[model samples]
Target: MTMMSLSWSLVSIANKKQQQIRRFKITIHRLFGFAFLCSISFFLFSPKIPRSPNYHQFADMRNLLGVPNTLNVITNFPFLVVGVLGLILALEGGFFTISSQAEISTWILFYAGILGVAFGSVYYHMKPDNNRVLWDTLPMMVAYSSLFSSLVVERIGQRIGLGCMCALLFAAFTCIVYERIYDDIRLCLMFQLILPLAIAAVAYMYPSNYTHSTYWFSSIGIYLLAKLEAVSDKKLYRANNYVISGHSLEHVCLALIPFLLSVMLICRERKFKRLGDLKDQL
Candidate 1:
């Protein structure tokens, strides 16, 4: 908590480590650019991955109380609750240690996307077909876009993060259009995998201005676990004696990401100045 104190740890890293950090800073942009180009090129040139023909089928299709896919449909109710509460807190302001309006705006978009997901997912589960897939998919994509953008705002800065948010939003729409025109959800799937990894990597590389960085890791871990649950839907359903489907549990698990993030916001404080900000001050 000492600002610019002559602490041994602050000025005492070996010369080789400093050299490595300097080299990393110098090549960071080019590294990201190359990775971006390679990812796009690979996806564009690769064989198209068509939406599985049986994608609409769910392990739990129980018509409970006149609702089809009842568990999956109802599980999204938590998103509604969490989304509304998070949105309100983000807008109400003064609760989080957010630095700028741009950061707040990104969070607002994040929660708004979650709210959209709640409704869209319910509608999609009602029929579970390509015809209704966009409603479910696009909202979650938007949520992922903004969630990552908000993290960027925290670690990098507001201006660049806002730009990234806009770009990601455009990409989200592109994923939908590509799916419609080419019948390939590969880009969308790739994005879902990429964003969490991006968040984890970025959070590790960038100096945060706040405490509780572990919360970011926790959220990412939960996201991966949700993906695992989704993939094991039938096994989980049978394992639990048909009480809950993995896909439904996935929804519940994903809901915890935002909840944990909200808790992080409330609990974290400005524990250190970003080194970049310090450099600028100098």
Candidate 2:
């Protein structure tokens, strides 16, 4: 072939390769999303593990009549259902894809659950008459919020959710510091170190999109912030030793995985963009 024909052939081949790589990534994301949904559903409702006595006792706060826990569960129930369904829809994007409008509609329902959790927690806390209601429901709210943001929200919505998540981490961090200063380091370490690391692990394990890296970033920031606070306060020694208060190596592992994955993802995205630019040149 002439030089010109050879060059054109190679360019066409490269473009085709980029398109195939993009499709493969999309397929992997969808399959992983479905698998993740199944695992999370199991974690939430599995019968093998014993239920927390506190969770049941809290449920019994009142009769099935307008009890807060019941009400809380019912009112916020749609989010859970939609969350599961969204994962299915996300999976369908792998096969019989829905229209973009349907996907957007599903996303709206999905993010509603996320924002509800943030707002719901504030509501739950303000009612001192129902501390049990607040405490029992808050964890679910936080969990669903994190999962919803990670799995559902898109470009703009993802950024908004990230801002909210950072606010939560900052609030948690501030509380930990204040508690450490006036009360004790124990509370701070638990809230700051343990909680962040746990969050990092959970977020890392979740099958999320490119924009959702904020969740991972926030998780790491929370840990890094806690570590800084501990060192500044001369509590690193306390954090590393002792049976109860020490920051374990396990926590370090949790933060590291997600942080490393975040780096890997950034590199991959840049590479994808470079390929797209080359395609445009053709």
Candidate 3:
């Protein structure tokens, strides 16, 4: 073929490829936009959902070896241990490395939230009231929102991720505060349910720079198991002759999740160079 014809053919192929890439990105953006709008609509239209009257009654109430709610209360200690460990790792820069200061701040917030969960959960299990439940759930929301934001930052872009993290945290706190004032939990429930699904979708859809992405899936699995155990708390207590309960196991599983995530961060490495360095590397 003539050189001019060959050159024209190559340019046409490159343009077509670029168009395809642009279309793909636009499609992804549209999908996310639709999902976001649906979520906001649900929150705005949902009716008030009050706390269940029997929500505070947990299984494993035995004063085992003179400890009240021994299994339930004791299992919660893992959260504190893991939380402290996570904080130490974050402070020591033992987790994954990031070039951005914003990313570092995000990690600190996430670890701090984990630490707060330790105290808040213990307090809630000690007395198990709506008032105390607030403490337990508030910190949990913080951790959830932070983790979601971190995933966003990693999968998406830095500025967009930071913005999302801030927006999500604000939404979470608003739900908690609104619940406290109005005795409604619909928004909180929506946040809890939607965030995980969104995170999972992001994990599946995006390319990760870090290894050990499976740890995110594992954490999600453990979280689902914990929820199942919590739901079956009374039945498990009865089946086990009151020695232990599903709720106790749930606590253990929940604690392990953050620990697993921390290990993932510590073990993971970037698979690619920074965006600006890509041209140099090429």
Candidate 4:
């Protein structure tokens, strides 16, 4: 065979290998995610035995929305472990597929996990008069920092990375607005929005002509929609603390959609006519 044809054949084989890898990773991710959900479901469905709010006090239904007692510190182990696995899978997705952008998914999951841990440490384990457990929640900040680093620093040289970071910043802002409107605002909102946007803008200011402006624009749009959903969680429940409506499913779906798409962008087989040919275009 001619060298050109031989090269094409090798490329074909490599493409197939990458696809198999992507499929395997995606399957693992899904299965682990299912297990995580199932664990939560099992805990939720278990009979509620009333007792002191120390060992399993926070295990009851009232604590599902947030931490109620120190038991959460113990109960959170299953979720924390599952979340760690999910984070690994997501990091692989980021490496393997632009369409998947596992960092995005990882951030969402990481956020949830850290939040659970933090809420539990702050509300359950800590003393009402003496505050010491507050420091235990620092993982939340670390997780956020890592997320921005992946999008802004790790993906900096590449066009797609820039686009993804831009979109994420926009989404973060949208979340801030939504939370503010819903009256569920937290001091963390300002830090989440401003710090990331500042970093992304500085990163983008360096002049360069790229083929994939669409990725940035599209990401921004998607992020706006997603943030709207995330912030809407503020309005999801009622005064009684019961989840009567507007639960977190929308936010999860929105976040997951971009994440999965970003993964596909990286790992899927397709024509490379132009950068824009890929939906992740980032």
For residues 1-282, write the lDDT of model 3, one tens digit per residue: 455665575577557645644654675588669867877787688766789868888867777687666777778788888888777777776455655666666777888888888889888887788888989898888888888878767766577668878888899889899999999887788788878877787777666767889999999899999999999999988998877899998888888888898888877877655445544544
TM-score winner between candidates 1 and 4: 1
Candidate 4 wrongly placed segments (more than 4 Å): 1-82, 90-137, 155-189, 199-234, 238-282
TM-score of each: 0.85, 0.28, 0.82, 0.34
Q: Clash pairs of candidate 1?
A: none
Q: Candidate 2, residues 1-282: lDDT per residue as tens digits? A: 455765686687567655644554564467558645755685466533322333233211222464543333343344344334443444445322222343334333334443444345335523423333334234433443343333323222344345545544454556444543554333333333334443454455443324435645654665475455423332443454422211222223323433343343334232123344555765
Q: What lDDT, from 0 to 1, does candidate 3 have?
A: 0.79
| C-alpha RMSD of each candidate structure in angstroms | 4.8, 16.1, 5.5, 17.0
| TM-score-best of 2 and 4 | 4
Give the winner by lDDT: 1
Model 4 lDDT per residue over 108-186, tens place: 5444544444444445343431223223323433444445444442333334344444554454455444444543333
- Lowest summed lDDT across 10 adjacent residues in model 3 is found at 273-282
Candidate number of the best TM-score? 1
Q: Residue 53 in candidate 2 has what lDDT?
A: 36
TM-score: the better of candidates 1 and 3: 1
Write the candidate numbers in order of decreasing lDDT.
Answer: 1, 3, 4, 2
